[model samples]
Target: MIVQFKDVKDLTSSPAKSEKIHVYKSGENKGKTRKLNAKPARTGILPVSEKTVWTWVREGKFPKPFKMNGRTVWRLSDVETWIAEQESKATILKEGA
Candidate 1:
């Protein structure tokens, strides 16, 4: 069977449990994978300042951002994964120490 979505809402609304939802910008990359700017990136699940984020990126501790029309953006998934890894590492360290 084939299904057709009439609008963005339709597409965003009922994803399967195993499916991953991707939020994207409205312009050229609309409906594609989402990208977060410095501000949003800093305000994510594990909040951190842009400066710290950049420092971590430079030190190979965080995900790198890609250029989007002269603007730098980090993939939301990548940020989430980084946060998860950090939490996992912290848990391991706490357990060990």
Candidate 2:
């Protein structure tokens, strides 16, 4: 049985566990399988929240995401560059100390 947000009596109210709610996870999500890099030059996985993504992009610290049809995505190269940069900086600080 599928329920909608509107069906809830109150937004602040909690529902009984027996209500038969169904959450889902796609089969691919259950494993350590990596995402298909369909567009290697224009797609990636970034460890960031939406808020921080936008901020970093605006500040030029992050790569500007590329558009696929209409959806924006980051390039794996850009993400790797950022990660390597961070690691380099960390090493420098450690060596300085």
Candidate 3:
């Protein structure tokens, strides 16, 4: 099944589950079977609330997100660099203190 998120509500919600997903041990699809409880991957982006992220963006505290095919998204490398810079800043503050 394919899912397309038109808005935040769609993105945050999960689809209905299906029973008995087929599995394979060898090359062919003839072995064991299990349920595949698929979950959306949330990586690279900050763990804070969406509101907080928007606030940070407005405050110029976080890297600006760009539009990709009309969908707003941030670059993984940019977020990683921001996180590293924040960690280094924290370390320097700790040392100074």
Best by lDDT: 3
Count clashing residue pairs per candidate. 0, 0, 0
Q: Candidate 3: misplaced stretches above 4 Å?
A: 1-45
Give model 2's clash tally.
Answer: 0
lDDT (Cα, 0-100) at 60 in candidate 3: 99
Candidate 2 local distance difference test against the native: 0.52
Per-candidate TM vs. native?
0.52, 0.49, 0.54
Name the top TM-score candidate.
3
lDDT of each: 0.55, 0.52, 0.63
Q: What does each candidate score in C-alpha RMSD?
A: 16.2, 18.8, 13.2
- Model 3, 57: alpha-carbon shift in Å? 0.3
Encode model 3's per-residue lDDT on 1-97: one tens digit a residue: 4422222222223334555586777766568786876655443234554676777889999878777788886666676688899999999999999
Cα lDDT of candidate 1 equals 0.55
Evaluation by lDDT, superior candidate among 2 and 3: 3
